[model samples]
Target: MTRDEIFKGLNEVFQDVFDDSTLEVEEETTANDVDGWDSFAHITLIVSVEKKFGVKFSMGQVSSMKNVGTMASILLEKLA
Candidate 1:
């Protein structure tokens, strides 16, 4: 999927996970950028993203992710 496509789905996941229908996430988005995105929420976000995209992220991948852009890149690599 294209980056735009990935972001489209990711946006949906973020909005749902954060319980904010109007939430829009960009490549630079990180936990600090979103309210209520603490550690627990991070785990939930990761699981939700995996389920949404049908992909699993390694612990390294999860820990190393710097931003939504990195996650999108990883998703692209895995999907490819």
Candidate 2:
């Protein structure tokens, strides 16, 4: 899938996880950039993302993801 498609899916996951339909995330977005995005929410987001995209992320992959951009890149690689 294209980056636009990835971002579109990510947007939906983020919005659902955060319960804010208006939420929008950029390449640089991180947990600190959003309210209520603690460790718990991060796990939920990861699982939700995997489910949305039909891909799995390793613990290393999860820990290494610095921001939304990194997550998208990883997804791109997995999907590829």
Candidate 3:
């Protein structure tokens, strides 16, 4: 899938996980950009994304991600 498609789906996951429908995610979005995005929430977000996209992320992939863009890039690679 394309990055835009990934972002579209990923945004839905973030909105659902955060319980904020108004949340708009972009490439540079980070945990600090959203409230309640702590370590635990990060894990939840990761799992939710994995399930939503039917993809599993390794520990390194999860930990190395610096922003939504990087995650989307990784997702694109995995989906390819």
Candidate 4:
């Protein structure tokens, strides 16, 4: 899938996870930068993304996704 298409799903995940429509995401966005983002929430977000994209994540890979850019790249690679 194209990055923009993937990003649309990403944006939905962000909106649902953050509960804020105004929050803008960038490649630099990380869990540390967002309030209310914790390990539990991260898993929920991952599950949502996996559902949206129909992909699965290994524990090691899930443990390694550190930021939005990394997540996007990984998702792209997986979908590719």
Find the candidate with the highest TM-score and give its number.
Answer: 2
Give the per-residue lDDT of model 2 (tens digit) for 1-80: 99999999999999999999999999999999999999999999999999999999999999999999999999999998
Per-prediction TM-score = 0.97, 0.98, 0.97, 0.90
Q: Candidate 4 — which pairs collide?
A: none
Give all candidates' CA lDDT scores: 0.96, 0.97, 0.95, 0.87
lDDT-based ranking: 2, 1, 3, 4
Model 1 accuracy (lDDT, Cα): 0.96
Q: Specify the highest-lDDT model's number.
A: 2
Model 4, range 34-68, lDDT digits (tens) per residue?
88889898989999889988999888879888898
Off by over 4 Å in 2: none
Per-residue lDDT tens digits of candidate 3, residues 3-51?
A: 8899999989999999999998999999999999999999999999999
The Cα error of candidate 2 at residue 79, in Å, is 0.5
Off by over 4 Å in 3: none
Model 4 has an lDDT value of 0.87
Candidate 1 lDDT over residue span 1-80, tens digit each? 99999999999999999999999999999899999999999999999999999999999999999999999999999998
Q: RMSD of candidate 1 to the true fold?
A: 0.5
